[model samples]
Target: MTTPAQTPRSQDLDRIESELIAFLEGRTRASWDEDVDLFATGGLSSMFAMELVVHLEQTYGVSIRGGDLKLDNFRTVRTMADLVRKLTADKDTDG
Candidate 1:
């Protein structure tokens, strides 16, 4: 099942969201939506964001660095998906 408005970017975000939810659920032993704030609920920490950065890099093949290291980017699954999309787009343009 798909929507008529599902662009490639949307599809990518969907995949990212599903994978992120699975990973977070496995780590926290709980389930959440893409918009849920993982940190606000006390289920995650700034330290855990590093592990997330590594996971994003390894899973998406995108190198996160500099300004992109901000904790806000990893606060929610939606934000993380957006970050991956941005990094992936940057990679596409750079190479």
Candidate 2:
């Protein structure tokens, strides 16, 4: 369970999403469209993908593992936001 201090608000989610989008935009030469497929379009590589997971875990204070680390969860910025929300909610409930 998370203490009140550790809980992430909706703004935090938005911030994380913005940071991720900015990071992806800067790292890859391709222009980022929020609806574009990051992997299919060659915007993100396997190495960058792992880096994203690490960033999410650190920034959101959430642990992602097993099925949670699948490509579907990491496919898009919106999906990433949803994954973080689910993980954060699960942690808070468990805590």
Candidate 3:
């Protein structure tokens, strides 16, 4: 179940997905699906992952740390979107 506030979060997630795809496409000739394993599929590397975290933090204004930096969170495009949604929601709730 999702609330009204989560609707905007969902939109943001979609936007992030598109942006990530664009970024990936610019980096490689490979195409990625939403469920593709970013790391295992070689779509992402540790160094690029750190860059991604920085980008997400700057773009979304969400501070990801501690438990948030797990492999599961960065596994796929969909999972990354979910992580962003969670972080964004946490930030909103805290403020």
Candidate 4:
């Protein structure tokens, strides 16, 4: 069974995927696979990546810094969602 926190986290991930796919679709005029490597596919720009960092930090209320600021972590929408889950859990436990 999903806990209360798990429920919102799952929903947030779905929302994140939706938002990202919408951005990609608007920019590339093509459907995006959830698991496709965004960097490899040239689907993301440096500006967009930074925008994603800001969006994740603000939307998830979790800071992205230090060792967590890795490009590999943002390879795909699913991976970014995973990072959000991890950072959010870390914040919860720390406080």
Candidate 5:
């Protein structure tokens, strides 16, 4: 649950997406396309995937639980940002 102060807005989500995209670019083999499949693009690896989950949890203040840890949820910077937004919204709802 989050207070109003903890809730993320549209600009904040955009900022998070931008930061995440840059983070992936630093770790990947090549530049990224927003819709590119991260796994296929070498943007993420199984060994390092959990690090992303941790980063999302710490950065967005949301928990990634059983059903939320799917590969599809992390397919791109857009998707990852969407996931964080969704999870954060869920927290707002639960609040």
Candidate 6:
């Protein structure tokens, strides 16, 4: 059973994972696990990261700038989901 706090997080993770998988469907052949390192595998390139950043920013309506723009944040599906959640939470708090 999920608590109220855990429910949103789980839903967010599921949504983010689905979106990431959809984006990567044709770009790579390998099936991606949430925690797997996207960079370590040949699944993504530096150039592709920019595209992903754009996708995330546009999709989530979150501005990922400054210190938030780190390669580590985009290293894997789970990390990317966490980054989105953080950015969204920050935006909610600020606005």
Q: Which candidate should be chosen as best, given lDDT against the real structure?
A: 1
Please provide, for model 5 over 1-95, each residue's C-alpha lDDT reduced to its tens digit, 9 standing for 90 to 100: 87555444767677878888787778664677667888886768887789989988998899999999999998888888888888988998998
lDDT of model 5 at position 1: 88
Best candidate, TM-score? 1
Over 1-95, each residue of candidate 6 has an lDDT whose tens digit, in order, gives: 87565687788888988888877775675688888888998778999999999999999999999988898998999899899999999999997
Residue-by-residue lDDT tens digits, candidate 4, 1-95: 87565687788788878877786788678788779999999888889898889978987788999888899888998888888888888888998
lDDT, candidate 2, 4-91, per-residue tens: 6544566766776787788777877556655677888787889999998998899889999999999989888878887988898899
Q: lDDT scores for all predictions?
A: 0.91, 0.82, 0.85, 0.84, 0.83, 0.87
User: What are the runs in model 1 whose C-alpha is more than 4 Å off?
Assistant: 1-5
In candidate 3, position 76 carries an lDDT of 88
TM-score of decoy 5: 0.79
Candidate 1 residue lDDT tens string, 5-94: 889989999999999999989998988888888889886887777898999999999999999988788889999999999999999999
Model 4 TM-score is: 0.74
Which has the better TM-score: candidate 3, or candidate 4? 3
Candidate 4 worst ten-residue window by lDDT: 2-11
Q: Which residue runs of candidate 2 sit more than 4 Å off their true CA positions?
A: 1-13
Q: Best to worst by TM-score, what's the order?
A: 1, 6, 3, 5, 2, 4
Residue pairs clashing, model 5: none
Which candidate do you rate higher for TM-score, 2 or 3?
3
lDDT for position 19 in model 5: 83
